[model samples]
Target: MSADLIYLVLGLALLLAVVLPIALSRCAVSAPIVLVGVGAVIGLLPFDKYGLDPVSQQAFTEHLAELTVIVALMGVGLALDRPLSLLRPRSWRGWSLTWRLLLIAMPLSIAGVALLGWWVMGLAPAAALLLGAALAPTDPVLASDVQVEGPSVTDDHDEIEESDQVRFALTSEAGLNDGLAFPFVYAAILLATAGPVAEWGLKWVGWYVIAKIAIGVIIGVVGGWLLGKIAFRSARESLAVARRGEPLLALGALLAVYGLAEVAQGYGFLAVFAAAMTLRSQERGHEYHETMHSMIERLEQILTLMVLLLLGIALTNGLLAALTWPGVLVGLALVFVVRPLAGWVALRVGHRSEPIGVAERWAIALFGVRGVGSVYYLAYAEGQAVFPELRELWSTMAFTIIVSVLVHGIFATPVMRRLERIRAAAA
Candidate 1:
C-alpha cells in the first residue's frame, strides 16, 4: 500500500508487460493470462490491506477504466487497415461483417443476457438490463490477440488493403460497439429512475438511441476530418503535424474530439473511435498513422496492465464474496452460450450477403473477449444510478471477464494458426 511498494509492483509489472508479449507469442498462453495469474498470486501475500476495493474506490475504478477503454478505442481505430467512409456507399461493402456483428449479434446478446438475468437469476428489471448492456460489447484492450495489427504503409493509397478478415471483423466490432452500448445502458438507468416505459420510453428512444448516436457520428466525422486537414492536408505547412512527425497529435486529437463530443452531449466513446478511423482514413498509406497507433498502443498496454493486476488482486480479496450461484450461472451462460449463439446467428444471417465460411464465422463468434470496457460501463452506471444488486453485479461481471480471459487466451493461438492455414489453402 505504500508508495514505494506500489512503485515496486508497477515497475515489475511493466517489465512483464514488455517481455510477455514476445515470450508468449508462439504459445497458447497470453500476456493477460500471465499478468492476471501473477496478480492473483500477489494477492495471496500480506498485501491484503493494500488491495483496492471496487466498492470504496468506485470513482477511481470508473475513471481508470474509462481512460483505458478510450485509449484502446483510439489504438484500434488507427490499427484498422480497411477504409470506411460513411459518405461513400461503396465503402460499406468491406465492412459488412462489422455491421452485422454490431447490429444483430449485439442486440440479440443483450436481450439474451437480460432474459437470463431476469428469468433465471431473478435480478430486478433495471439491474438485469444493466447487466446485459454492460457485458454486451467486445473489449478492444484485452482482445489485441484477436484484433488487427497496427497499420503498415503501402504504396497504393486507393487499394483496399485488409487485415485478416476475421481479425478485421472482430477489431471493428470491438471498436464501434463500446459506443453503441450506451443507449441500452441509459435505458436501464431510465427504467430504474423514471419508474416505467410509459414515463420514459419515448425520451430514451429519441435522445439515447437516435439523436445521440447521430450527434456522435456527425461530430466525430467532421471533427476528425478537420483534424486530419490540420495534420496532413492543411494549407499552411506548419499546421501539418503529420509531415512534422508529431505522433503525439493522436493524443491531442483523442482528447479534443472526446471533450468536444461529450460537451455536445454525444457519446464520447463513439466520438473517439469515429475520429480515429476518420483520421486513419485520411492518409491510408502514410507512415504517420503507424506512428500514432504505436504511441497509443504502448500507453494502452500499460493502463491495461495496471487494471488487470488490480482486478486479479480484487478477485482473491473479497470481490467475489457476494457472488452467488445465480451470478455464477449468468457469468457462465454469457461466455458459453449468449455471445457464441448470438454471434453465430448474426453470422449465419449474413452468410448469403458475405461469404464467411464456417471457420471464420466461428472464430469471430467465439472470440468476443469481454474485459475493461465492461468494467467501465458498470462503474459509470453505478455512478449515475443506484442498483440494489450492485455487489452481485460486480462479482458476476468480474467472474465473466476472468472466464473470457482464460478461455480465449488458451485457445487463440491454435485457432488463429489454423485459420491462417485455411486462408492459405483457399488462396
Candidate 2:
C-alpha cells in the first residue's frame, strides 16, 4: 500500500469512528456491524493492496488486540457502579453479579466449549482447550451497550445506585474474566509444548493458576492503592498535577500496572482491571473519573472500529475459507447454545438475591459477546506454538466472532433499552 492510500484509509476510518456510532445510536444496527461491513465492501473493491492477512501479521494482530483489550478493561473497571466485595456466604448479597459470572458462568462456558471443540469439532485436546480459553471471556470492546455508561456520582459513599442487572452482570463478567481466562490459555500452551496434561497438571496448577493469580491480585491491589493515593491525595505541593484533568494519567497507570504485572510473571489483564477499579474507588464521586473514562472510551472506540474493519477485510479475503460444516455448527452452538446454557446455569446456581429475575438472567446469559479478546488469544497462541489445525481454529473463531457481532450487536440496544424500561417500571 502506498503512503497516500494509507492516509486515505486512515482518514475514512477516523470519519467512520465519529459518524457510525451517532448514526446507529438508537437503531437496530450497531457500530460494529457497520464498521465491519464498510471494510468488507472496501475489501471487495478489487484493490489488492488493501487486504490484510491476520495469520501472516500475527504479532501486529496480537498487539493491536492486546492494546484494545487493556483499554477496554480499564473502561470496564471504571464504568462499574457496584462495589467489589469478598466471596463469603454472609457477604454473598453484597457480592456483585460479576462474581457469579466469573466463579460460575465463565468456567462452565469454557468447559462446554472445550468439550464441543474436542468431541464435536474433532480438535485435539490442546487445541480444544485453547479454543475454549480463547472464546471464554466476553469481549468488552463490542459490549458497550450492555455496560454502564461511565463513572457515576452519588452523594453518599455507601449509596451505589443499582445498575440494571443485565448491564452490571455483563460488565463485571467481562472485566474479571478477561484476566481469569489467562490461566486456561497457559494450560493449553503447556499441554502443547510438554505433551499431556498428566505431565504438567501439578506445575500448571501451582504456577499458572495459584501463584500467578495471587501475584496479579497483590500487584493490582498494591499498585492501584498507591496510584490512587498519588492521583487523588498527594502532598499539597503536588496537588496541581492531580487537578490538571490529565486523562492520559489513566493510560499511564494502565500501562504501568499491566507492564509491571506481566514482567513479574503475573496476569496483566487482572492487574489492569484491578488497578482501574481501585483507582475509581479512591474518589468515587470525582469528576476526574469521568474525564479518565471518557478518554479511555474514545481510544477504545477507535481501536475497536479498526479491528472490526480489519476483520471484515480479512473475511472478504478468505479468512473463513477453511471453515467446515462442523466448524460452522460449533460456532453457532457457542453463541446460541453453549453460552446461554452456561450463563443460565450459573445464575440459577449462584444468585442469592431477588435482584435478578428470570428475564434479566436470560438476557445476560444470551449476550456473551465475544470479539477482539478471542482474536488476541488465538494470535498469541499461534505465535507461541504451531498447531496443525491453525486454519480451522481461525475459521471457527472468525465465524463465531462474526455471528456474535451481528446477532448480539443487532439486539443489544433494543434489548437493553427494554430491560431498562422494565427495571424503571418495577422501581
Candidate 3:
C-alpha cells in the first residue's frame, strides 16, 4: 500500500474511533471497544495502515505509556474534590477501604502472583517479582465507571450529590497505587542487576522500600501544599493570571506538582493526587473546581481511547506470540482469581456504614480492570532490564490487559447500574 493511502486510512480510523463511540456511550460500551475493534480490523487488512510500529522503537513504547500514565495521574489529581483527613468515620471508612486494598490486598495479590510466576511459570525470581509489581496497580482507565467524579465542594448549600464512598476510595487508591507499585518494580530491577541476593534483601526489601515510600509521600505532601498555595494565593493576588472560572489553571497545578515530585525522586502519581487534594482544600467552594475537573476528564477520555486503540493494534500484530501456557495462565489467574480473593479478604472487615452486599462486593472485586499501568510497567521494565522470557512476559501482560478490558469494560456500566438499583430498592 502507498504511504498516502495508509495515512488516509489511519485518519479515517481515528475519526471513526472517536465519533462512533461517543454516539454509543449510552449503550454501556465505550470508546475502547470501538477503538480496539477498529485497530484489530485495520491490522488484519493487509496494509500497514494502523500499526504502532513505533513501538518497535523501544524508547518510544517506554515513554508513550509512561507519558500517558503520568498525564492520567494528573487528571486523577485534578478531579478529586475530597480532603484527605481520616477523622470522620465515613471519611475513615473510605480510607479503610483504600488502606486495606493498598496495604493488604495489593501486596497479597502481588506476592501470590510472584509465587505463581516463580513456581508455575518458572520465571527468575526478579522477573517474577517484576510481573507482580507490574500487575499490582489497577488501571484507572478501565475503572472510571466506579471512580469519583468532579471536584470536592466545601459548601453544603451548593447542592451537588457527593460521590459514593466506595467509588472515591477505589478511584483514589488506583491513583496512588500506581506510584507505590513503583518501588517494587525498582526492587525487581535492582535484583535483576544485583551482586548478592542477601545484600538486596537488606538494602532493597528493607531500606529502599521504606525510603522510597517515605520520600514519595513527603515530597507529594510538601510539593502539593506549596503548589496549592501558589495557585490559589499568588495567582489570585496577581490578577494577571487570575481567571477564576477557568479550570485550565488546574493544569498548572498538575505540571508543577508532578514535575517537582519526579525531580525529587518522589512518586509523581502520589504527588499529583496530593496536589489535587491540596488545591481542592484551598478553595473548596470555588466554581472553577468543576470546570477544571471537566476539562481534565475530557482529555483523559481522549487519551484513554488512543491508548486502547494502540493496544488493540499491538495485540493484533502478535503482541502475544511469545506467551506460554503458564504465562497466560498466571495472567488469567491474577484477573479472575488472585484479585477477587484479595479484594474479598481486604474488605472482610465490614464497611463502617453497613458493608456492601455480597453481590455488590463481588461485582466490585471482579471489575478491578487492568489497563494503562500494566503498559507503563512493561515499558518501564523493558527500559530498566532485559529478561530471557521478555516476550512471554509481554504477551502475558498484554493478554491479561486485553481480557480485563473487554470483560470489565463490557460489564462496568451494567454492574454499576444494577448496584445502584439494588441500593435504591433497599432504601
Which candidate tops lDDT? 1
lDDT per residue (tens digit) for residues 77-165 in model 2 = 88876666333355346544667788888898889899989998899988999999999889988999788788787666577555576
Which parts of model 1 are misplaced by more than 4 Å? 1-5, 235-237
Q: Candidate 1: lDDT of 325?
A: 90
lDDT of 3 by residue, 151-181 (tens): 6555663454344655666777788788888
Which wins on TM-score, candidate 2 or candidate 3? 2
On lDDT, the stronger of 2 and 3 is: 2
Q: Sort by TM-score, best first: what order? A: 1, 2, 3
Give the clash total for candidate 1: 0
Displacement of residue 297 (Cα, Å) in model 1 is 0.7
Residue 7, model 3: Cα distance from true site in angstroms: 6.8
Q: How does each model score on TM-score? A: 0.97, 0.95, 0.89
Better structure of 1 and 2 per lDDT: 1
lDDT of 2 at 315: 88
User: CA lDDT, every prediction?
Assistant: 0.89, 0.85, 0.71
List the candidate numbers ranked by lDDT, top first: 1, 2, 3
